[model samples]
Target chain A: MTSDSSSTAGSPEENATSSSVSGATALQDVSEYSGADDDLQKEIQTAVENLECCQSEIESLNVKVAKEILKVKQNYNKIKKPIFDKRNEFIMKIPNFWLTSFMNHPEMSKIIDDVEKEVLQYLTKLEVEEFENINSGYRIKFYFNPNPFFKNEVLVKEFSLGASDQFVSESTQIDFRRGSKLRKRLRDYQKMISKAKKRSKKSEEALPRSFFNWFVENAEDSNDIAKYIKDDLWSSPLQYFLVSDV
Target chain B: MTSDSSSTAGSPEENATSSSVSGATALQDVSEYSGADDDLQKEIQTAVENLECCQSEIESLNVKVAKEILKVKQNYNKIKKPIFDKRNEFIMKIPNFWLTSFMNHPEMSKIIDDVEKEVLQYLTKLEVEEFENINSGYRIKFYFNPNPFFKNEVLVKEFSLGASDQFVSESTQIDFRRGSKLRKRLRDYQKMISKAKKRSKKSEEALPRSFFNWFVENAEDSNDIAKYIKDDLWSSPLQYFLVSDV
Candidate 1:
C-alpha cells in the first residue's frame, strides 16, 4: 500500500508562517511570546523534528501492519475457497439461483435494470476469484447458459490495484447477438446523449443505466460494484438469496 | 466482534415462500417449475443446507480473523508506544501545541466554536491513551492550565467497546468556575431549545454546536469524533499541523 508522503515535511519559512498564524490567533488570551525568545523557538523546532521522526517510525510500522492484514486475508481465503467451490456446485443445481441472488442483493439490485434482469435469467454461475497476492485485487466471472442476448458464455470483470494503489479494472467484451434488444437500446441511449452534448457544452458523460453497460464501461471508473460483489455478495450469497422472505 | 445472525437461516415454509416469490418474478421468462417436482425441490433444499453449512464455516473463520487483526493492532501499538511517549514529552514543551494541532485538523476545526477556541488556549497537553487490550477502547485526556473557564486540571473522555461490540463512552465531570461563560451559554441554549419545543411539537433535539458540548453531551452517541482523533489525528498530528501550508 502506498502511503501519503506529501505532508511529511515543510520548508522552514512555511513552518514559521504556520506557527505565527496559528500561534497569534490561538494564543492571544494566553501569555504573549516575545519574538526574542530564542530558547523556546529552538525547543519547538526540536519538538517538530521529534514528532516527524515518530511519524516515520509509525509509517514503517504501518507497512508491517498491511503485510499482516494481507496474510490474514490470504489465510482466510485459502480456508474459504474449497467451501465456496462446494457451495457453487450446489448453487449450480438450482434454477435461476444467480438471477434471484442478484435481485435480492440491495446494492446489486439497484444497478440492474429491466433489460439486465431479463438477461440475467440465463446466469448459471457467478464466481469471484481473488488474486494470489490478495492485495493486488480480484476478478468476477459470470457464466451463462445459452441465451438470446449474446454469444459469449462468460463475461468477466477483473479489478487490480495499480502501483500507486489505485483500483483499475478490465472487462470482457460481450458478443451481442444480431437484432439484440439490449444492443439497440444502448445505441439509442448513446445517440440521445450525443445529441444532448451537441446542444450543451457542459453536458455530462453518459451514465450506465444497465448492469451490462456498467460492466463493460470505464475500466478506470470507481470500483464500488466490484467491492460490493467481492466483499459482501460473494462471501455470503445465501444471505442475499434469502433476503426476499423478510 | 459480533456477527449478524439474522440472515443465517430461514424456516422451511419461509424458504419455500422465498423461492416461489423470487422464482415467479425473476424466472418468468425462463421455464416454469411445475411445483409437483418433488425431486427438484428436495435437491434445492439440500443445496440450501450445504450453502448454510458453508456460511457457518465462514462465520467461524471470521472469529479467527478478528483475533488475528487484534494481534496486529496490539503488535503495532507496542512498537509505537515508546516513540509516542517521547514525542509527547517534546509536545508538552511547546506552548499551544494541542490548540494549534486541533485548529489545523479539518474535522476538529469544524466542531470548534469561538468560545471553545478561547477556552482551548488554556489546553497544555492533549494525550490519547488506548486501553491495554487495544480492542477494548481508548481515552482522550486534556490537560489544562488554571483558567477562569474551569477549575479541573484535566478533563478525560473514555470510550469502551461493550460485550456485543458496541461503543460506549464515559466522561469526567467538568467543574465550571463561578461566572463561567460556557456554562451560561449552554443554559441559554437549552432554554431556547425548550421554548422552541413548547411552540412546535415537530422540533428536533438540539445538536451540539461546540466541541465542549460534543464532549460532555451523550456518551452513547456516534463515535465518529473519537475515531477521527484516534485513527487519523493522533497517528500523525504533524500531517494536519502542516495542512495549512499546502
Candidate 2:
C-alpha cells in the first residue's frame, strides 16, 4: 500500500511540474509576439512618414514647373500684346488691298473663284491662324479694280511678300478680325498664367533652402538682407535645394 | 690674511656663476626669436591661402550671375522671336498706307503742301528715333512742302495726335515705307541671340552645381555638366562666389 501511495505522489508531482513548464513557455510566446507587434508598428510609421515626404517633394516639383511655364507665358504676353495688335493691322489690309490688285490681270481673273474659296477656307476672322499659314513665296489671287469697279475680276499673282510689300501692287492682302474664340483663348491663357504665378509664390515659401543668404560675419539679421554690407546672394540657389532619400 | 683669502675666493665663485647665468639668458632669448620668425612665416602662408579663398568666391559669384542673366535672356528670346516678326510686318505698312489715305481725301488735299512739309521735318529713316517721338494730332500748311512740291511756306495742321497716333489714325494720312526696317531689326536680334547661346555653352561647364542638377536626371553631350556629376568636388564651387567679406 505504501509503494502504491509513493507512485501516485510521483505522478501528481510530475504532472504539476509539466503543467507549470508549459505555462511558462506560453507566457514567453505571448511576450515575444508583443515585441514583434511593436516593431511592426514602428516600421509602419516610418514607411508612412517616408511616403509623406515623397508626396510633398512631388507636389513642390509640380508647382515649380507650372510657375516657370507661367513666367515664360508672361514674358510672351509682354511681347505678344504688341505683336498681336500689330498683326491685326496688317491682316485687316489683306483683302482690301489684295482684292483691289487682283482685278487687273486677265490670266489671274480665271483663278479668282478658286483663290477666293482657298482664302475663305482659312479665313475665319482668326488672324493668327491665317498669318501663320501664309507661305512667303506662294501664289494667290490679287485684284486691282483701279476704276471704281466693285465687282471687278481678281488676278492670281505669285505673292512672296516679306514683312511689308511696300509698293501698291496687285498683291495678296489680308482682312483679319477679332473672333470670339480667339478672345476667349487669350483670356484663358492669361488666367492660367495668373494661377501659375500664385502657385509659384506658395512654392517659394515651401522651399526654405532657396532663400537669399547672408555671410557668417553679417548673420545678425539673416532674415533681412540689409544686415549684409553686400546684400547679394553668396551662391547659386541650387546648392541648397535638397531631395529627401527616395 | 687666511680670512681675507677665503672671502675673496668665495666672491670670485659667485661672480663666475652670475656671468654664466647672464650668458644663458641671452642665448635663450636668441633661440626664442628664431622660433618666432618661423611662426611669422606660417601666419603669412595662412593669410595668403585665405585671400585666395576669398578671390575664388568672388570669381564664382560673378560667373553664376552671368549665367543666370544669360538664361533669362534665352527665355526672352524664345518668346521675342515670333512676336517681333509679327510686329515688323504690321508696323512697316503704317507710313505709306496712312499717307495715301490722307492725301486721297478732298479735305486733306487742301493742306497737302503743309502735310508734306510736316512729314519731312519729322521723317527719319532711323526706326529707334521714329518710335520714340510722338506725333501731334494735326498740323497743316497751305504753302510749306518738302517733297519737291513747295519750297517755303507756313505749314500747319489742326489734328490732335498723341503717342499712339502712328498706331491709330486720327485725322491726316502720311506716306511712308514699312516692313524692311522691322525685318532688318529682327535679323539683327536673332544674331545677338545666337551669340548669347554660344556664351551660355561655354559657361555651362563652370558651374558644377548647375551642371550636376542639369545632367543628374537628363544626360546630354555637355561635357562640363557630365564632369560635375561624376567627379566629387572636394572644394565647393559656391565658396568662390562671395561678393565681399567683413
Candidate 3:
C-alpha cells in the first residue's frame, strides 16, 4: 500500500507543476533573485533537506505502527475464532442458511440469477479465512451438500496481496455434471458471444450474468464483493441471515 | 464512530426492507410452515441469538483494537516531536517559508486571494497540534509577524470531536487594523451584499473572497484544508516549501 507516506505526498513534483504557480515559474523567480533572496533560498533548501529527514523518520515509525496494528488485529481474530466457530455450528442447523444470508446481502443479491439462486439452495456453509498476515488477504469458501449441478462439495475463492499490494484472486474450478443447467446456459452464452464477434470484429464479449461466473472472473478492479463478504458478512453472518426476518 | 458494529449492521431492518424478498414475505412463508419447518425456525432463532452474542464479543474486542491503534499513533507522535521541532527551527530561517509552502499547496492556494497572498507574505510559522486523544481532533495555528494586515500574532483554528463525533471547529477572531486594506475590502463586499439583499429578498450573501476570512469562517463541511495541513504539510513542510524548486 506504499505505507501511507508516498500515498499522502502523491508525487510532490506532479503536485508542484499542477499548482497555480508552476515550479518552473517559481524557479524563474528564484533565478532572478537578489543576494538576500539567494541566501534565503539556500536556507530554505537546508530546511527542506531537514524536513525530508524528519519525514523519513516518520515513515519508519509508520511502518512500525502498521505492524503493531496488524498484531492487534491478529490477536482479536484469535479471540473471535471460537465464538465464530460456535456461531457457524448453530447456523448449519437451519436449512438454506448460507443461501438466505447471501440472498439478503445488498451486493450479493444483485448478481444472483434465478438459476444461481436454485443452485445456492444446496449451500450448507460459508467461511472466510483471512491470511495470517491479515494484510496479505483472505479466502472465502462455500460448502455445499450433494448437489446435481457440480461434483465438488466445496467451492473456494481466495484473494492474496500481489507483489504490488493489489488484491489478486483465484477460485476453485467447478466440475459441472453432464447436461447441468448452469453448464448448458454458459455454453449457449459463449456460442452467442462468438457468433456476435464473427459478425462484428469490434464486438466486445460480455461476462455472463450468473453468480458462478464470479469465481472465474478476475475482478481486480471491482473486488468490493469479496471485501463485503470478508469484512462484513464474515464478521456477522447472523445479521444477514436474519435480514429476511422483521 | 458508533463503534464498528453498528456501522456494519446498518439498521438490519432497513436492509431487510430493501432486499428483493421483503421480511414480511419471508415471515408469511414461515407462517405457513410445516411441523419440521417450525422446529427449524426455533433452532434458527437460537442460532441468531448465539451469533449476536459472538458479535457483541467481537465488538468489544474492536473497541480495544481502536484504543491500541490510538496508543501506537500517540507514541509515534511523541517520538516525532523533537525531529519536527528541529525542522521547524530550520524552516524559520527562510523568508516567506510558510507563505511559499501554502502557495505551492494545491488545495490551500485555491482559497487564497491576492490580498490574502500579501497578508500571508508576513506569515512566519505554521503549526498543527493534534489533540492528545488523537481522535478528539486537532488545532492549526498560523503565526505572523507584526504586519499591516491584522493585530493578532497568531491566528488559531481548533477542531474538536463533538458529542456525535462529528468535527466542529472554532477560529480566533481577527482584529483588523484601522482602514486596513482587507478590512476595507470586506466592508465594501458586505455593503454590496446588503444592497443586493435590499433589491432582492432572495439574494444569497456569498463569503468574502479573502484569506483572512478563513480564520472567521466555520469550515466543518470542508475541513480537508485543515486535514492536509495536519496530516500532510505538518509531517513534511519542506516538500511543499521546496515544491517551487526543480
lDDT of 2 by residue, B1-246 (tens): 001101111111111211111223323322322445666544433333332343334344344433443344345334433443343233222233223323333333333344343443332111111111112221222222244322333322222322432212111122223543323433454565457667787665332222112212222223322222111110111111111110
Model 1 reproduces a share of the real contacts of 0.52
> How much is A32 displaced in model 3, in angstroms?
8.7
Worst 10 residues of 3 chain B by lDDT: B1-10
Best by lDDT: 1
DockQ of 1: 0.32
DockQ (Cα-based) for each candidate: 0.32, 0.01, 0.28
Q: Candidate 2: misplaced stretches above 4 Å?
A: A1-228, A231-246, B1-41, B92-246
A1-246: candidate 3 lDDT, tens digit per residue: 111111112112112221222334335454423566666666655555555566566566666766776687688778877877776786787777777778888878877878888898998878888789876767889999898898999888887766653567788888999889977866766676467668777755543444676565555333667656765577666567665532
User: What's the lDDT for candidate 3?
Assistant: 0.65
Candidate 2, A86-159: lDDT as tens digits: 43343333332223222222222223443242332332122111122222222323233322212224433232
Give a tens-digit lDDT track for model 1, residues B121-163: 8987777887877656679988899999989999998877665
**Winning candidate number (DockQ):** 1
Estimate, for each residue in A4-59, the C-alpha lDDT of model 1 and write its tens digit: 21221111211112122233322332223446277876666666666666666666
TM-score of each: 0.77, 0.17, 0.72
lDDT of 3 at A55: 59
Judged by DockQ cut-offs, is candidate 2 incorrect, acceptable, medium or high? incorrect
* Candidate 1 residue pairs in backbone clash: none
Second chain only: TM-score per model? 0.73, 0.26, 0.76
